[model samples]
Target chain A: MERTRAPFAALREALHAAEERTRLPVARLLLLVLLLSVPLWPMVDSRWLRILVLVGIFVVLGLGLNIVVGYAGLLDLGFVAFFATGAYTYAILASPASPALQADLNWWLAIPVVLALGAAVGVMLGLFVLPLRGDYLAIVTLGFGEIIRILLLNVRGLTNGAQGLFNIPRPELGGWVLRSLDQWYWLLVLSAFLIATAVGRMRASRMGRAWEAIREDEDVAAGMGVNTVKYKLMAFAMGASIGSFGGLVFAGFFQFVNPSSFTLAVSINVLSIVVIGGMGSTPGVLFGALILIGLPEVMQFSETERLLSVINPAVPFADTTDWGRQVASARFIVFGVLLVAVMALRPEGLFPARRPQARLPERHESTA
Target chain B: MFWFDQFVNGLTVGSVYALIALGYTLVYGILQMINFAHGEIFMIGAFAGWAVLLLLGGSAIAGPMLIVALLAAMIAAALASSFSAVVIERVAYRRLRNAPRLAPLISAIGVSIALQNVALKLTGGRDRVYPRVFPTGEVGLGDFSVGYIQAFLIGSSVVMMVGLIVFIQRTRTGRAMRAVSEDRATASLMGVDVDRTIVTTFIVGAALAGVAGVLQGLWIPNIRGTMGFLPGIKAFTAAVVGGIGSVPGAMAGGYFLGLSETVGRELLNELPGVSLPNEWRDVIAFSLLVIVLIVRPTGIFGERVSKRA
Candidate 1:
C-alpha cells in the first residue's frame, strides 16, 4: 500500500510540472485566437482587412521604436528617417530606371537591400550623434529626419522629387499575386507574428539585458562590463533594420513611394504607438499599434461619420466641395487628443509588463 | 548685389529666431522641460495680430488706428501666450513632476500636437494674409539693404530682450525666478512660490514667442496653422546652441543659427560646382542643427547641468 501511494504521488508531481511547462504556450495560443478572431467574426467587414494591414505596419514600426525609445530610453523624434530610407531604397532599386533591375523587383530581394541600407544609415547616424544625449539627441534626430526628407524632396534625379515614385508593381510569389486586401492582410499577420516572435526571443537574450542596463544607468551599465557603445549601435541598427522591413512591405503593398508618406508626423504616430501601448513590453507594442491604427480606420466609416455629424452638425460643412480635406483634417485632431489622453492618464500603457505567476506547491504532511 | 541682400535677409530671420529662443531658454532655466507648444503660440500671435489688423483697418479705425491695433496685438499676444503657458503647466506637466523625466517630455509633445490641431481648426486649415502694416521700403546701409519690416522686427525684438534682462536682473520676482532655477527645493524654503514661478517662467517665454509671432506676421505677411512648427524647432535648436537654461544663451544661439544658415546658403552658392536653390533654404538650416548638436551638445554658451538637478 505504501509503494502504491509513493508511485501515485510521483505521477501527480510529474503532471503538475508538465502543466507548468505548457502554460505560457497556452496563453500565447489564446492571444493568437483573440487577434485572429476579428477576421472570423460574421459581422466583420472586408474593409477591416485593410485596417489590419495598417495595424501590422504600425506594429512593426512600434516594435522598432520600442528598442530605441523604450529599451534604450532614447527619445528619437526622427525615427521616420529609417522608414524613408527603406521606401526610397525599394523605389530606386525596383524601379525600371536602374540599368539591370526591372520596375518590379522581387519582394524578397528588395527587403534585404532595404534593411541593409537602413542599418547602414542607422549606424552612420548613431556615430554622428554619439556625443549627444537626452534633448540634444532628440533635436539632432529631428534634424536628421528633416534632412532626409529635404533630400528626398530636392534630389529629383534619384527620388523623382515631390511627385514621388509611382506604378511600382505589387509583390508576387511565383506569379501568385497578393492582389486582394485579404491576402495582404494575412501576409502582414504572418510577417508581424514572425517578427514579434523573434523580437520576444531577442528581448530575453543577452542583448536585451544590456539595453535594460543602459536605459537604467549608462555609466553603471558601462561599469558592469556592458560594452555601451557596441550595444547602443546594435540597438540602433536592429531598430532601423526592423523599421526598414516595415517600409519595404509598405512600399511593396502600395506599389508607390512618396516623400510625404514618410514625414515627422509618421514618426510621431509611431512614437505615440510605443508610448500609449506601453514602452518595453512586446504585447504592449502590438496593442498600441492596433489602437492607434485601427481606431482611426474604424472611425472613417460613412455611418460613423454620419453619427459624428449629428453631434457636431457644423463640422460636415454645407458645401461638399472639400469633403476630402474635412475628412483628412479630422484625423490630426483625433490623433492629437488620443496622444494627450494616453500620455496623461496611462503613460505606462494599457498592457503593462505583468509579473510571472508562481507555481503552487503541493500540500504535504511532515514526517514525524 | 543679390548676395548682400541674402545676408541681410539672414540677419533679419536670425534676429527673429533669437527673440523666440529667449522664451525657450527662460522656460528651460526654471522647468528643464522644453515647451514644444511655444511655436504654436507664436503662430497664434501672428494670426491674432492679422485678425486684429484686418478688423481695425477695415472698420472705423484707420491710419494711426493701425498703430493702436499693433499695440493691441502685442498685448493680446503676450496675454494669450501667458495663458497657454499657464494652462499647459496645469494640465500636462504638474502631475508628471514626480514621474519619470520622460513623462513630461511626452506630455509636452501631446500638448504641442493638440495645440497645432486647435490652431488648424481655428484658421480653417488655410493661410491668413496679414494686412500690410509694416512698410516694405528698404534702407541702404553701405552696400547692404535692410527693409523697414526687418528693422521693426529687429528693433522690437532687441527692446523686448532689454526689458526682459532688466526684469530678471532688477525685480524681486525675477530674482525669485533666478533663485528657483538655481535650486527649486531651496527656493521653496526661501519663500519662493515654485509652482507660480514655473508658471511665470512659461508666461514670460510664451509672451516673447507672441511678440516674435507678431514680428513674423509683419515680415512674412502670411500665416498658416503649421507656420510655427519649423520656426519653433529652429528656435529650440537656437536655445540649445547658445546654452539651454541661460538667458543670454538663447539670444546668442538664435543669432548664430540664423547667421550660419545665411552664410551656409551663401557659401553653397559660391561653391565651384554646388548650388542650392533658394526654396531649399531649410535644408541648410536643419543640417546646421545636426552639425551643432554633434559638435557641441552643451552649445556654445550652455553649461551642463547635473543629471540629478
Candidate 2:
C-alpha cells in the first residue's frame, strides 16, 4: 500500500505542476493568436464583422463593470450612464452641434474627449455615492441612470430628443476614411484587447488587492491601512471610463446617438456579461461577451421557422407573430435563465482564478 | 385656487405613492434585498386589474356587484403577484442565499427583466384600456372639486394603508414577519416559520399593490405594458425616502413622493419664465432619490443594520 501511494502521490504532484505552469501563459498565447488571426481572415463577411464589433464593445463594457462589481464589490446597476455620457460627448463634440468641429474633428480627438467626459461623469457619480453602500447604493445609481436618460430625452435642443443624433462621420486617419464595417471591426477588437489587458494588469496590482480586501471586509481593509474610499472610487472611475470608451466606439460605428440606445437594459446586459464571465477575471469578461453576443448571432437559425420545421416534424413552427418582439424579448429570458443557472451550478464561472499554492506539510508534522 | 388644486393633487398622488412604497419597504425589511422584481409584480397587478375591467365591460352591475368585481380583481392581482414573488424567490434567490450579496441582486435584476418581458408578451406590448366601470361624477365643496374616481383612489389607498398597519401591529402572522425581518435565524430558532412568514409577507404586499393597480387604472384611464414601470419606480423611491424597512416610513415616503411629483409639476408649470413639462416629472422623482441618498443613506426613518460578518 505504501509503495503504491508513492507513485500516486508523484503522479498527482506532476499533474498539479503541469497545470500550474501551462494555465496562464497558454491562455495568453491562445488569446493572442485569436486576436491576431481575426484581422488576417480574408473571407470575413460584413455580418460577421458587425458581430465581432459588438462582441468587442460589450467585452470592454464588461471589463469596466468588472472593476466596480468584481473588484470593489459595489453593485452599480446604472453603469450605462457612463456609456451614455461617452456617446453623447462624441455626438455633441463631433456633430453639427459644435460650431468648432462641425463634423470635421478627427476621430482621435473625439475619443479622448469621450474618455474624459466619461471619467468626469464617473468621478461625479462616485462622489455622489461615496457615503452609501449595498442596496441604497444600487437604488441611487439606478436613479442616476434614469435621470441621465431623462435628461437626454427632455433636452431636445441639445440631444435632438427621441429623433436621435445621426450622420456621425466615420473615423478618418490621414485622409483615409475607414467607412467599412470591417475597418470598424478591427478598431473595436484592438480597443477591447488593449482595455482587457490593462484591466487584467490592474487586477494584479496594489489597487486591485485593495479592492479585493475591501470587498471581503470593508472594516478590515480600512483597519489594514488601505484607503477604502479611494480604492472604491478608483474602481468606479476606471470602470466608468472603460464603459465610456466602448460607448464612444459604438456611437461612431453606429453613427447614431439616442436616449433609447442607453437604457437600463444596456446596463443589465453589461452586468450579466461580467457575472457570467466570472467576476474579477479579465479573459472571463471577454469569453462572457463572446458567448452572450456571438452565440445568438450564430444561432439565429434556431429562431427561424424554416429551420425549426426541418428539425421537428411534430411541432408546427409557423404562425409565430411578432417575431421581432419575440426575438428582442427572448434575449432577456435566456440571459436570466443562464445567470440563475450559473449562480446555482458554477458561481466561480467556467474558468476560475488560480489559487496560490501552499508548500507540503513538514515531515515531523506528517509523522506526528 | 391653483395652489389649493396643486396641494390636493399632491396629497392624492402621495397617497398612491404610499401604497406602492409599503410593498417595497415590507419586502426589503424581510429579505434585506431590494426586490427588483417588486416593481414588475406591481406591473403584474396593474395588468391583472386591467384584465378584470376588460372582462366586466358594459355590465350593469350595481354598487355591491362593482365592489365584488374590484375585490375579485384585487384577489387576482395579489395571487398573481404573490405567485411571481414566490417563484422568483425559489428559482432565482433561494440558491443565492449563501452566495455574495451581489449574486441575489444581479439575479433579481434578471428576474425583473424576465418578468417584464413576460408581462410585455402577455399584454401584447400595447396599452390595455380599463373599461370605464366607475362613474366619473365630481364632488364639489367650496369651489373645490374631487372626481369620484379620485376619491375612490384616495379613500381605498388610505384604508389599505391603515389595514396593513393594523395587520402588522395586531396579527400573529405579522409578528412572525417582523421577527423574521429582525433576524432570520433567530426568528426560526424562536419557532417562527420563516419561509411561511416570507411567503405571507409577499402575498400581503402584493395584495396591496393589486388594489393600488386597480385604483390607478380607474383614476388614470390607461394601462400599458410599461405603465407599471414608472409608478413602481416612484413607489420604490417613496419607500426609500420614507425609510426602508419601516412600515410607517413607507407610508410617509410614498405620500411624500406622490406629493412631490404632483406639486413639483404644478409648481413648475406655474413658475414664470420656468415652464417644466409633465414628462420631466419622472426626472424630478429620480433626482429626489439621488438627493435623499446623498443626504441620508438609511432614509428618513430606517435604522442601520450592522454589516454581515
Candidate 3:
C-alpha cells in the first residue's frame, strides 16, 4: 500500500499544481465565460449555436444530477424521468396538440407550475426509494424511468400515445418572441449560470453539509444529529426541479415533446457528463458537457470531415471512405469507451471538485 | 387450459431468465456491484450462437446434425461471453474494485452502450434469424401440452442449474468463489487468489447468460443487437426479487417473475375491465420489483440486504 500510494501521491500533487495554474477566481471565471459566450451567437452558424445550446442544456442537467449523485451520494439513474415529467408537463399545459388540458398556457406563466411539478415528482420518487441504498436505488430509479416512458407511450388520452404532443409554444417575454437558436442558446447559458451559482451556494450551506454527511454514511449522519431524511428529500427535490427546468427549456427549443426523446440513454448521457466532469464539480460539469455533448455535435460538421481526413491521410472521402459519417455514428461508442477508460485510469473525473481548505489563525509570535 | 398454456410459457421464459439472473447474482455476490454490461455480454452470446448456426448451414440441417450444431453453438457462445466478461472485468472493474461504487457501474453502463452500438454497426442494425433447430412438435397430456422447443429450454435450464450446483458444491475453484464472496479480505488471507476467483465467477455467470442468449434466440427465432436490454433488466429484477446474492433464490425469483408476468397478467385480466395488452408485461415486472423493494427489501429468500446495502 505504501509503495503504490507513493507514486499516486506524487501524481495527485502534479495534478493539483496543474489545476492551480489554470484555476481562475470564481468572479473572474464567470465573467470570462460570459464574455466568451457573448461572441458565440454572432460568430458561429445557427447549427453550432443550436449545438452549444444543447451542450448548455446538458450542463444544467449535469449540475442538477451533481446535487443528487455528487453531493448527496444518491445515484438516481431515472433522472430522465424528471426531465420527461417537466417536458411532458410543459407540453401538456402549453401545446395546442395536447389532448387533455390544452390550456395553451404561456411559457413564462408555466415556469412555476413546471418547476413545482418537477419538485413534486422528485419528492415522490425520493419517498419511494428512501429506504433503498446504492445499487438498489439505481435499479429502482431505472425502472421508474422506463415506467415513465411506457406511460408516455401508452397513455393515449393524455400524452397522445407515441404521436407525442407537437407544436409546443416557445418562451415569449412580453412582445419579443424568443424563437431563434441564438436566443435559446442565451436562455440556456443564463439558466446554466444561475443554476450553477445556486448549486454552488447549496453545496456550502448547512443543507449541503448535511447532504455530504448523509452521502458518506446515512446511519452515521443520522447518529450525528443530522436530519438525513429531510436533507435527502431536499437534495432530490432540488435536483429534480433543475432537471425539469432543463426539460422545459428542451421542449420550448424543439417545439415538441415526445417519449422517444426521454430514454435511459438521456439519463445515462447526463449521468456520464456529471461523472466524467468530476461528480460534484461545477466547472467539471461544464467541461464534461463541452467534451461529451459539444464534441459529438461538432464532429457532424463538414469542416470536421476535412479535419478527419487530414488526421488520417489513409482515410478516403465520400462513398469510398465516408469516415465522417462513420465517426458521427461512432460517437456513442466513443462515449462508452471514454467512460470505461476514465474509470480505469482516472475515476475522479477530468475536473475533480476541490475540497474547501480550512482557514487557521496565524500563530502569534508571543504565543509561539 | 389457457392458464396452463401460460404457465408453460412462463416456465420456458423463466428458465432463460433464471440463467441470466445467475450472472447478476454471482457478480453482485462477489463484488457488491452491478455489472451493467452483463446484458451486452448476453447480446454477444446470441450473435455468436447465430454465427455458428449460420456456419453450420443456415436452417437446413436436421436430426443428429442439428443436435451437434446446437451444442457447438452453445459452446461457442459460452466461450465468447466468458471472454467478453473477463475483458470487462479486467478493463472496467478490476481497477475500480476499491474506487467509489458509482465508478464501476457508470463504466459498465458505458460498456453496455459501446457493445450495443458496436453490434448495431456490425450487423447493420438488423435482426439475425436463428436457424430452425428444434423440430416443430409438442407433447400433450390430456388438456396439458408443451412445445418441443419449450421442453428443450426447460430441460436444458434444469440441467445447467444442477450442473452449476454440483460445480459450486464440489469443485475447488467453486469453493474459492464462495469463500471470496463470503469475505474477500479473509479469503485472500486464507491464500485464495481473490482475483482469479472473481474472474472465475464472472466466467461461470457469463457462460450461463451466454447459453441463455442462445436459448432465447432459438426460442424467438430472431436475435438482434439491442435484444438483451429488456431480458437483462428483467433478469436483474429476478435476481433482486429472489435475493441478489443467492443462487437458489435467483432461480426461484426468475420463475416467480415469469409466472407473474404471464399467468399473473392473465389473472389480472380475469377481473372485469382489467384487460392489459402484451406490452404491459414489462410494466408488471418493473412494478413487482418496486413492490418487492418497498415491502420486503431483503427479498423472498432473505439475503440480509439491509446490512450490505
Q: Score the docking of each candidate (DockQ).
A: 0.51, 0.53, 0.61
Determine which window of 10 residues in candidate 2 chain B has minimal summed lDDT.
Answer: B53-62
Tens digit of per-residue lDDT, candidate 2, span A66-154: 88988888888899899898887788767764323355566778877777777778888989888787777777888889889989987
Best by DockQ: 3
True contacts kept of 3: 0.61
**Candidate 3 wrongly placed segments (more than 4 Å):** A1-43, A313-320, A357-368, B306-309
**Error of model 2, residue A217, in angstroms:** 2.2
Residue range with the least summed lDDT across 10 consecutive positions in model 1 chain B: B300-309
- Where model 1 places Cα greater than 4 Å from the true spot, the runs are A1-24, A97-104, A309-329, A354-368, B58-63, B305-309
- Candidate 2: the clashing residue pairs are B14-B255, B17-B254, B18-B254
Which segments of model 2 are wrong by more than 4 Å? A1-26, A35-44, A97-103, A296-305, A313-329, A348-368, B57-64, B269-272, B305-309
lDDT, each prediction: 0.78, 0.76, 0.86
Chain A TM-scores of all predicted models: 0.83, 0.82, 0.87
Cα deviation in Å at residue B147, candidate 2? 1.3
Give the per-prediction TM-score of chain B.
0.93, 0.92, 0.98
Q: What is the lDDT of residue A363 in candidate 2?
A: 29
Clashing pairs in 1: B243-B302
